[model samples]
Target chain A: DQQVKQNSPSLSVQEGRISILNCDYTNSMFDYFLWYKKYPAEGPTFLISISSIKDKNEDGRFTVFLNKSAKHLSLHIVPSQPGDSAVYFCAAKRRGIQGAQKLVFGQGTRLTINP
Target chain B: EPEVTQTPSHQVTQMGQEVILRCVPISNHLYFYWYRQILGQKVEFLVSFYNNEISEKSEIFDDQFSVERPDGSNFTLKIRSTKLEDSAMYFCASSGDAYNEQFFGPGTRLTVL
Candidate 1:
């Protein structure tokens, strides 16, 4: 069973525009959420994260909004650059299913930034 | 900036051969994890380690798989009997604290024939 889902397989945006990537999860146990960006052949790199207690968290040009009640989260990259073109994955973590628990990940959505 | 790193970048092995993938997690990090991503698939957690012991593991991590912090700076994953289905990119990650962002290594692409 997939607890985290990125319904969209791909997203494209004009350079310098805002790009929004959406994610939904079915597990109510998930309390922390994170977004990762990946280029081919490299590992996923951490972007931003938001806990269930907070509605939003922002880091530089990246912002992540979490709606706990809706079990939804979105990552927004403003003034998207060509470098931002990559695969984006949404991940979720519960407090403790096991000690030092692990994060459950979405299938990932490929984002393309058009110049 | 310190980063996690893996060795052999890519490994090719025959079926049923034992393969060991090595990782050097960031120093000062207490939590370490192993995750795998099949082509075009989500990254799935395999195991988590802390204090030289396994803290958590998924069903996918069967007896065929083992993890160890054999020394002060190295963490390793050993697959006892490789299978074609085991072919995928394996990533090693480490975090300073629980629930914090984990830094991942470039990954070791394992191809089992």
Candidate 2:
């Protein structure tokens, strides 16, 4: 299913520039949105999350903005570091029976920060 | 930090053989899940387990697939008579509760010959 989508397959930014990765979803029932970072041959690591009640959430140099009207979300990283190079995946969560909720994930966007 | 752990990082078996993938969820987590990612595809949910029973499952999870928590800490996914389409990376995940943030383990790559 294409409920969640990351249209950008890859992104490149200079070390000191701002990096932006975008995501979109067709499901309105999704109440929670999260970003995950993944390295080669490794499991995805949780980075940040935002609840539907809020439009923006920030952590350190990373920020996530959700536009409910557009059903779109974007992750921004400032002063991008080389360490930030990895595949970023966007996921959404909906309430499920007995609380064993499952996640719907988007195709990952590979972010590369060049020094 | 507490994290989910998986065994048999990689496995190769005949298409008709049965295979079991094992995982150890975080100690304090109460929910468990399995998701698979085929090459060059999005991660898809297989099933969710809670209180020793399956609470939810996806269309991808059919008669050939089953999940079990035989003990307190271990979770296992068994595929009966695997198919070539079943070759993919299987990830084990745990959350503090349903619809909560989840922690994932390094996936086990299953290759069906």
Candidate 3:
């Protein structure tokens, strides 16, 4: 059941620095990759997503880079802020029967931004 | 900014008791799903519902588990017999379409004593 994996369990960065979080997947059938941020006692919130057809997708301070050949994807947040400190999860979507799809999530990396 | 919502933020039930976790998907969304996460574990998909029927289910969604959309706005996950391993955070999500990002509701923490 380890189709998606975020090897880093925790990451720390200072304010105004770039924060990079990496994820890897073993399943090639995944059609989309997404990054989710979660806080304690809360559900995951989608931040950004990239389609398999593209190599990069960016939204404001967040950018996601995908390398299909290596089966790896990474999220970069420039000038990371304290508010960005939370558990970050990488997820992959695969289409299922009847067009229903499900997201497979990683173990999550706890990102801590120090002021 | 319509968002998914869930009820009963926390529930504690005795083993073997039945429990139902309720969720209200975003309005105009047609697809719904249930996922759960045990402490320190990855979120696992339980089932996906579409067109009033279960479109897909994972192995973890065994005979004891079921999902229903009894009303227009409400989706629910019911467990016939709660077990110790059933204690986890159950999340509900919905999407306007099948391939896009699915909005998630604040999870309901279920504890089977």
List CA RMSD, all candidates.
1.0, 1.1, 1.1
Interface DockQ of candidate 1: 0.73
Model 2, B26-113: lDDT tens digits are 9999899999999999989999998888988999999999999988889999999999999999999999888668899999999999
Interface RMSD of 3: 1.8
lDDT of 2 at A74: 97
Model 2 Cα lDDT, one tens digit per residue, A1-115: 9999999999999998999999999998888999999998888899999989899999999999999999999999998999999999999987543563888999999999999
Model 3 per-residue lDDT tens digits across residues A77-110:
9989999999999999874334649899999999
Q: Candidate 3's error at A50, in angstroms?
A: 0.2
Candidates 1 and 2 compared: the better one by lDDT is 1
Q: Is the docking of candidate 1 incorrect, acceptable, medium or high quality?
A: medium
- After superposition, candidate 1 runs with Cα above 4 Å error: A96-100
Q: Quick one: ranking by lDDT, best first?
A: 3, 1, 2
lDDT of each residue in B60-110, candidate 3, tens digit only: 999999999999999999999999999999999999888888889999999
What are the runs in model 3 whose C-alpha is more than 4 Å off?
A95-100
**Recovered fraction of real interface contacts per model:** 0.79, 0.85, 0.73
Tell me the DockQ of each model, to 2 decimals: 0.73, 0.73, 0.70
Number of clashes recorded per candidate: 0, 0, 0
lDDT of 1 by residue, B16-77 (tens): 99999999999999999999999878899999999888999999999999999989999999
